[model samples]
Target: MSLPPTFDPVRALSLARETLSIEATAVNAMADRMDDSFARAVALVLGSSGRVVVMGMGKSGHVGRKIAATLASTGTPAMFVHPAEASHGDLGMITAADVVLGISNSGESEELTAILPLIKRMGVPLVALTGRVQSTLGRHAAVVLDASVEKEACPHNLAPTASTTAQLAMGDALAVALLDARGFKADDFARSHPGGALGRKLLTHVSDVMRSGDGVPRVRLDADLMTLMREISAKGLGMSAIVDGEGAVLGVFTDGDLRRLIEKSGSSVDLRALTAREVMHPNPRTVRADALAVEAADLMESNRVTSLLVVDDAGSLTGALNSNDLMRAKVI
Candidate 1:
């Protein structure tokens, strides 16, 4: 019986690292090759009134789906259609206004090439990401992005590996460049991704989670300290607004203030004799009711305060918000 070769983990790691280094070098080389072709490709997609239709096959199809998703999330409207499916009547999904971005390493993928003439007949512009610039698909394309790799990470040079990675990165580059060209803002991204954390931070407003009017824990400036406690507990906000006869916020008294006051006075006993005005912190940090939730969070952190009264442009108390509100809004 032949003896089993001894395991060499060190050699295995070195080879893996070498593969990654080679792939990195290949990607760096592409940066220098980027030229007018990239600009033309961007112009074509930006000028199109319809979505960018991305199509590929096998591993290329998987990469295309991700590229489509990235483009869609970053302000470019795009969708993936499998080439095999396109031959089965999915070709109808492509419109004259659209731009087709076909990805194939060899640029000779039969399924993708088969649909080229039909797409051209419909007047849809084609962008090809391929290694072979002289291949049929590249030759037919209106713009070709060279995603060539010198070698595959696969020891036998059979797997896609480095080629696919380069394609994915190139897709990202297009999506980001298009995003900037369109002046797509964080708020725009938030609208498309309302369920994501970035959406919450950018879309949530002070009015969305603030306690308004009677819901805000507030007591008249003349109210006793005992009345203040009742107001805070009743509203469950751990703080009470000290308001004047005009209902304008004069100051705020928080649980922290009460604790400190109690410690200073050497008594947690009856203090109803003292009014809320005497113990409140004047001119507490405030936010406008129309301010972004993220701004409110910033104010809270910078002021070292947990809560802020929401006021209108006229300085009239409109609502109240706390760190808990920001958390609930996912702005934290």
Candidate 2:
């Protein structure tokens, strides 16, 4: 659709919508195209003891890399090897135990077509994702997935737009199906992505990030004002955990508590006589050392506290941490 000489935001928006609708239609068409081929491809990857080796070139290579990453991060062990690179002594990466997934919009990339026979000769199962099922790569594949598209989102319809999108969607579908077959969970995903936010939320325990042993600011319940002040100052957490003789956390005394005590006592109050149990906030919020660090962060935020005392199941102090600790660990 062409706009008139006059500028019109509505007309421009309509053209954008038309592009999206065309791509969406392409993806929907692929749903009906799914048949025994997709099933066979899934079975090949799932049953393989080795990895799912994905091969592609150009834009298909970009999509293939992401598909390989998704599959590996999910439950399937997958890797991407460029077809051109594979022909140049990289074919050794594939073995008889592995299954090869080749992606090409036209199914006739000379590089991919050239390597199919070698991969097959090695007794590796070949699965092809292509727009043309009759092309050379498709003809050589044991399983042919029809990743056809009606049109490209590009105005000239020359670029691989909708076709690449279909390939990506189909790859994601296959990965998720294998993930379900293996009963992959959030914890399993986190194991593969330990540095990501989701991994921190699911895998980083309090003990992994909290200050332990002497690093924790702790004082006995019978400790005097001077002792509590020194522990809090030395820890620089603006707080101290008050524990019983057995190391069980009894209460928490923060800078806020000191301010409140000063307000109530005014001048001429005896600081030397004060004890942790007298001014400390008893039964302070606590988290287990083995708990997720994200859980500790949530506890601190909800309680409006800067630090928390880490405890074991037996209610003994094991560690301590403040908001800064969570921030340092990138758990905040």
Candidate 3:
């Protein structure tokens, strides 16, 4: 059968605009309603020495998982326990040291309510995020976080649209508050997300991925040009450092320098008599071994080079890291 052409586009657009406006207003209302109870909920989770167990049913459970993830990543240890699973022995996961955060817009989900008594019996501090302050779960909870909204964004007023959004926003608020309260920093966050780019940027050090010792292409300042060429060819770094008797990096001879030297004095000239100090570029770009790999990559990119010399606090050569090393570390 052919689709009807008489569908009202104007009415559909009007309803869409009305729903968006209503949801926007509802979120603003929820933000305005945040009070001391919200603070209490955050404090309860923060003070708990054990994990925060979040439990709910349906959409609330889905929102609870996201809340638990946010809390866990932001330094507040948290995990989600499905209400149905809690009744089927998962409740054992809840302990007296844990703080139970229960989410239910109606505050009367049977599956969620069924395990409430057990949570209470375990002496777990209860923090409820619900629309009704007088609801059973809210009344039983040690802290009642009001996530009430005026109406559902759904046209039929049945789907959990506005309520879930409000719940998610409230969860974010709690996570951020706890993050700031606990002084959680980016480095701490990186530790939890070690596989992510942020971890590569923050946790990686120059020494961790750098080429070091004999693997670092280098030559004594008095070495002949031919010997320097041999060092560069064998090391595969396309450049060789010129060093003093004490092993201090004096300068560098690079592929670009070789090109220039060839152009100025014919490549056929005997290079053995030439000293490394005569052809090496003095004071090459360097980075401390402990510096972040991101910084090293930035230095290499800014200076228009492919590699960086890694040095100790006293300016002694510790290693050498190239752009490829940063790529391998995922710092790029």
Candidate 4:
């Protein structure tokens, strides 16, 4: 490849802006063109007993893959099958229980149109995403979604730029409508994306990332200040929970309290005279073990504390966790 003799930055920037504007206009026009056909397409997918088998060719195939992925992650079962491959043996993947979503900007792609008759004969509902509803692919469809674009973003008006954008926007609209109809919530989305950040936040619980048993730093109420500090340092949680004889949390002594006590008392105060009960902050923030880890992070941020006491429903100290623990679990 050779560089252009003279690179015109002005022309390049102008074309880039024009391309974005055209695609934006195409997608906006699709939103305005949404009609009963779009709703019927959503209904067809919802009514299907199996998955949504999305088929497209060329650039439309790329958009179909993305649409299928979005639909599958958002509570709708969907998969993308290449049009040309479907003509070979991939059509066996489709069944009567599934719905076919065919994409063709011209509604005349030989690969896609070749399988339209076979798909129809299978008694499967065909939802067409095409520019020409009167073409072969659209005429044989049970529901036709108009994805027509005024023009392509390409300067020569040959590439599949604006038309592909319209198809993508229409696919997203269908997925969102079906998601709402199925009552798909954030938790449902998280379940599908277990390795994602949202999944970590919604699925991780306090107990899953908390320090339990001897791992928790705790000192008796009557324990000396030195014992409390030792426990805090030993556990590396920056704080020590003061518990009663029944192992119930009474208060918490944090490193902040220690600094304040030393600053107020100066060098004249006897450090050995202090007890856990005297220096501990009463009613420290607590979280239940069953609560979400993200909830613990929010509680820490709102209270401006780095550590929290994980307790049972009966108010007994069951575990302990700090901001570091949540971060380690990737729940922050």
Candidate 5:
């Protein structure tokens, strides 16, 4: 691949800036031109009981796939079907209960237009995202969304640049409107994207990541400092809970407390003779096992602590967690 003989750095930069300006203008113009048609389109899909079937060709088809994904993730059920493939028996994917969203800058792609009559025969409502509202695709649609652009960002004005931008912006507008109407929330979006970070934060609970049973580091309130230190070392949590006979957390002691204790007492006091209750920090922050993992992170952060005692409704210690546990779960 060789640079064109006419390629100048200054010219390239200017052209890039002009391209962005043209696309931005196209989107802004579309926003200003929005009318009741946009709302009606939203209402049309909302009223439907079936999924939205999206279809397009070429670059428009690529944009259609993205729109479908965005809609699905945002609570609207949608999928994209290739227009050319629809001609070869893929039209069976459409159902009378579904709404078809057709995308084309010209509104006259042969592959797309060829299926308009079949879609009409099936009685599936059509929503057109096109530059020309009077073209064949628009004429067959029950609701028409004008995604028209004044000109292409391409210097030749033949490529699909600003036109495609307009279509994408219009698609996003429709998805957002539908999402709001449906009362879609972050949790709903996370459900569709369970592999993403938001899902982990919203869906993962403290019990899922906390150390349970013997994994929890704890010592009786009457235990000596040596026993407490041994428990903390074995669990490797940097801390041990001071629990009563019934397993209720009374207090906690960490390596930091040990260092501070040694610094304050020096060799003047016998540190080995101290009891867990006497050395532990009372009223340590605790989190409910049912709480979200992100909530635990927030509690730890606000309290300037790296660990938390997991308790049940009765305040009985059920488990424990540290910053390392959260990091391992990717919830931090």
Candidate 6:
């Protein structure tokens, strides 16, 4: 109401820096506070026959959802259930075989407290990520991981800024530890995220999208200019592969070569007499069918070429693809 104080860059920057420093300090403090409780929680999750059920209220619930996703993507089965909803039939989603991860900044969220007794009666392992060990949620939990921070980043110290940051960090630590314990690899991650661009880059093979089985523009080494142009036009790849009788790639011919040859010879050379091997670029850039599609893309960009010939270990032409194929495959 009082004109919002005068706008000052120095004061605004100081506040921003202070907030970051406070949150960073909270995360580091959580790291130092890691004890046997964190290890116990990890082991319980890893050994559980059922999924991890994560529950919280308010801002804690938001953090719990992200934690569940991280666990699911990193080789652990997990799901988030709202504490308030758990009391109204959502508890059916839980089972005796599951491990329950409860989050409460004060360790006294009433909605969580209502279901703690039931989880105990069912003999399910309870892992609590909380700020107060003496509070109700802490006492009921079998293992308690402290998520306390020195203070909130908010000037009034009333919001959940630093506290939520610590919770997220601890959640990430749990997921990463579980990932290593399970020997989760990049291929496993790619399988879980097949629709993403990174998944395409990692999972797509050179053979999956290449033009093969007569689609590749192949011609004999001694083919004439008409034969070379016909092969390129028929395949629609802007280039042709010159191969031997055994299908071994001897050289490659492209539109650029045609232009250069015509310019150098003053457009007077006999087209029918020009052979493929005489004008083709030998030892062209090639990739194996088993290699990752991203590697092929990297090669194309580095060499400034639009297409690559896919060959086998024996250097025989098997397939071919251009930039458009990579774009359609989402590897571009």
How does each model score on lDDT? 0.90, 0.90, 0.88, 0.94, 0.95, 0.93
Lowest-sum lDDT 10-residue window in model 3: 265-274
Alpha-carbon deviation at 221 in model 3, angstroms: 1.1
TM-score of 3: 0.91
| Residue-level error in angstroms, candidate 6, position 51 | 1.2
Per-residue lDDT tens digits for candidate 6, residues 1-332, read 54556878898999999999999999998898788988899999988999999999999999999999999999999999998999999998999999999999999899999999999988899999999987899999889999998899999999999999999999999999999999999989998999998799999999988999889999998889898999999999999999999999999999888888888898578867989988899999999999999999999999999999999999999999999999999998
List the candidates ranked by TM-score, beginning with the highest.
Answer: 5, 4, 1, 6, 3, 2
TM-scores, each model vs. reference: 0.94, 0.90, 0.91, 0.97, 0.98, 0.91
Q: Which pairs clash inside model 6? A: none
- Error of model 2, residue 113, in angstroms: 1.3
* lDDT tens readout by residue for model 4, 209-322: 999999999999889999999999999999999999998999999999999999999989898889998998888899999999999999999989999999997789999999
lDDT of 1 at 73: 93
User: For model 2, what is the error of residue 240's alpha carbon versus the real structure, in angstroms, after optimal superposition?
Assistant: 1.4
Per-candidate clashes come to: 0, 0, 0, 0, 0, 0
Candidate 4 wrong stretches, greater than 4 Å: 1-3
Query: What TM-score does model 6 achieve against the real structure?
Result: 0.91
For each of the candidates, the C-alpha root-mean-square deviation to the true structure, in angstroms, is: 2.7, 3.2, 2.7, 1.4, 1.0, 2.5
Per-residue lDDT, model 5, residue 316, is 90
- Report the CA-based lDDT of candidate 1 relative to the real structure: 0.90
Model 5 gets an lDDT of 0.95
- At residue 77, what lDDT does model 4 achieve? 93
Q: What TM-score would candidate 4 get against the native?
A: 0.97
Which candidate's TM-score is highest?
A: 5
Shift in Å, residue 273, candidate 2: 2.6
Judging by lDDT against the true structure, name the best candidate: 5
Tens digit per residue, CA lDDT, model 2, 56-165: 99999999999999999998989999889888889878889998889999998989989888987899989899999999988998999999998898889998889999
TM-score of 1: 0.94
Pick by lDDT: 2 or 3, better one = 2
- Show the colliding residue pairs in model 5: none
